[model samples]
Target chain A: MIVSPTRRRLLIGSAATAAAALLGGCDALVDNQHVARVLEGAEALNKDLQRALLSDTTLAREYTEADMSPVFKANGTQHPEGDAYASLLDNGFADWRLTVDGKVDRPLSLSLAELKQLPARTQITRHDCVEGWSAIGKWTGVQLGTVLKTAGLNTDARYAVFHCADKYENTADGQYYESIDLVDAFHPQTILAYTMNDQNLPVAHGAPLRLRVERQLGYKHAKYIMRIEIVDSLKAIGRGRGGFWEDRGYEWYAGI
Target chain B: MFHPRSRSVGKPSSSDVAGATQKKLVFRHPLLVRLTHWMNVLCLFILLLSGLQIFNAHPSLYWGKYGADADPAFIDIRAYRDGNSIRGETRIGSLAIPTTGFLGASEYNGALSVRAFPSWLTIPSYRDLSTGRRWHFFFAWVFVLNGLAYVIYGIAAGHFRRKLVPNTNELAPSHLAHEIADHARLRFPKGDKARHYNTLQKLAYLSVIFVLLPLMVATGLTMSPAMDAAWPWLLDVFGGRQSARTIHFISATLIVGFVFVHVAMVLLSGVWNNLRSMVTGRYAIEVEKHP
Candidate 1:
């Protein structure tokens, strides 16, 4: 009838264990879901601690030309294959239009030249990959904040989901995609990069446009971007997670 | 007095009239030391396992700013096809050594797969980067905090100086050679001499606590992109992010070696006594007989 603090803690722990057992059956590893959940709780703590300790206004370290890597290896899929992508590549992306819809007040579709026509900023920054490699390169593009302002973000929009043309692992439902919260979305260095190394973005490096989230890892920089959708929740996205790699067990907020 | 006061050791009481001496039990480890030691054991165990899991995601070590699939790495662990079967190998640049049961190939889900570092060695025992990172970051905080507590308390209570720092006599080449010779022969000091740490123990403990642990933590922070913006000096100090990672791996490997020797010593000397000293802060000291 009476439960001490330690006893209560034990009871709660056992309850969690029981729930984990039920969920573990669906996963490959035993008790993985429960363990993952607890770990995610810890990750949330880390996220909050980092956000509080780090200023949002602070910029990522900018490098000089000398620091750039001679060859920035293309991460993930280098080139996307398909008739539609082939036609877009043939026209030099002349007819390609990036759709900005979802929770935006004014849904707009802008061409590649139009995005380049906007005020452009170029900076050299290191692209630190989650796979334990890094490469510095000069990226030129319009600030994502500038485009978001022009499109007029709705009051309730919380995240910017990037729909890309790249297909990862042949997931039939859609192409490779990624998302970021408003905090990273408006960061000064967060740009829709259209050029790499003073040249138009190559096919291997996400031609046309790509997201440049300087504060995060390489996977967060969605390549071959086709559309930008503002939304309140990521519940309806790929596997109900933020990005392609995220859905495949990479951290959603990969600041590290 | 049987022993000198300069050594800070208790002299066994003896009366010549009756020729009787009472054996004494000295408090070996303090409560703080015992608590931190056990805490370190748990934290370090989890941190090491989780760290291995994280490393399995990219089983390669490079020495520069940029190193990937195309670039040659100083260390690489991968599984490749050999004839008709898949074989695992660990390569150090041009040298490829078979590591079928360990590094490159491992048993997973009751079947031999291309899992790096084996399943038993990892926390989740599966190829899950997110889960590995979560476990790693969680235990890393615990490990750091436990280390800090041990360090602050060790300095404040003179634990480092009194127990872990070798004096001038112990630091002498002759004395150090003797200690090293004794260690090579599996000989440990007993009675009064066993009451405090030896010169070799002092050096190992000092380096691990003061040097290696901090370097591991610093190099880890340097690998973080966000931390680069917060503290750019980390990159400069380590030369590059990838170099920091290699350093981190080397430091962790050294710590693993330390743990092996530390445990072996504990078992070789007296497992029960050593464990009791760490857990309950009590150890039975061997008494020496004098004529």
Candidate 2:
């Protein structure tokens, strides 16, 4: 039972391949509607691999204030120039109320003051954009899990969908929104951040409130959150995909 | 020197030992070398295509930590609207290169689509970052493992020391100059001289294997947020994640350049022999008479 180094290496490689194959279907995982659909299984496999390797509670890297980038560029749309949004902005978002509904036992609307009074956690974390850039900034907000618990999620609820104030290009269904699974929804760092860098979250950077799923990419952090809707399935969402960008070719799960 | 031709079931002939004038088939690359080489070729191709797909999401390259649509970029490939049509250009600082055919804008299904890299060159052949990422990561695992195996085998078998490292005599300024001059004139080595790597080939192979490949892997890992927690020193080593990405793109470009030159050289200096050497580990080398 002597194995040469090359043979041993090949054995290890094959074992890895076997594990991946077991996790994913060998054949086409999804129909080739989009070429990306073909990789649905691989994405699932990766998700499983990451989950198996690290605990769900494992936190993303937190940096010191000194490590913060001099300038944190506001991503995506800077402002939404609609009358509703304009009036909300003009009044310093005082009239804004984040409605937590959909698949929740208690559908409650909480004002900005009410959210601020809740237990808050301040963190300095890096925002890694899928576009190959990173910036660190201090965020202060209430844990999303706390808010969800207060809202009393229905047993069937599997995902938390965050509806945002910003729109992408003013299309017919232009409301920018994003969602996360329960696993990420209740993660310790997952928060609805209302403040950035000790100041109220600027209009340029998702003023009033923003979803900060630290483990995921910048896109997953839906800005200017208008509603927090817990849903049983993402099938009926925008374009029947999980998120706005996810509908437009981005990965629904951007944990990496 | 263990010619694979001799191992054929038909048996060896007296001609196996040539009379010293004709060509002789030499066992140049080993089984492990060939396997790793081919595997790397596949992985590198997939990685490159998938990487391009990822890059298409934001067709811009920056220097420091923060970069977005607002910030100044060193390289920006953009496709913009004109009167009733669209055109694309790759800008490097002030110089704009019209790269409409292949980059920035390219033909997708007979229609001029604003794709940074054409469909033929991307893994998914469409804008699917998730699928592209999955392909990239899966092949990346293969690439890293294969590379590890290759490096281990090279060290254990003394392949690097024997074949890749330039000897002291070859390192001599006069000899190095001669090698450079020979390569410049497209004059490749033949006969027994061709059996061993020339100084330039040795340098190229060594640099690619030791420097560029490792750098690509490191920079890639550095860009991963998970890896950032695992190995924070990666950020220090490459300045930051964004800087690592910039380095990764540069390294990939260099590797692509290397592959182009490598392929051209293979075609220039006996494609069949070189191909055979890598494939079946048998390279027919010239045997000089009365040398």
RMSD of each: 7.1, 8.3
TM-score of each: 0.87, 0.78
Error of 2 at B273 (Å): 0.9
| Residue-pair clashes, model 2 | 0
In terms of lDDT, the poorest run of 10 residues in model 1 chain B is B1-10
Residue A255 in candidate 2, Cα distance off native in Å: 2.8
Compose the digit string of candidate 2's lDDT tens values, residues B22-72: 566778899999999999997998899889988998888876555666667
Off by over 4 Å in 2: A1-38, A48-73, A76-92, A99-108, A148-159, A165-176, A186-188, A229-241, A247-249, B1-20, B79-88, B94-115, B118-120, B123-131, B156-158, B288-291
Q: Whole-model Cα lDDT per candidate?
A: 0.83, 0.82
Q: What tier of docking accuracy does candidate 2 attain?
A: incorrect
Model 1 clashing-pair count: 0
**Alpha carbon lDDT of residue B47, candidate 2?**
90
DockQ of 2: 0.23
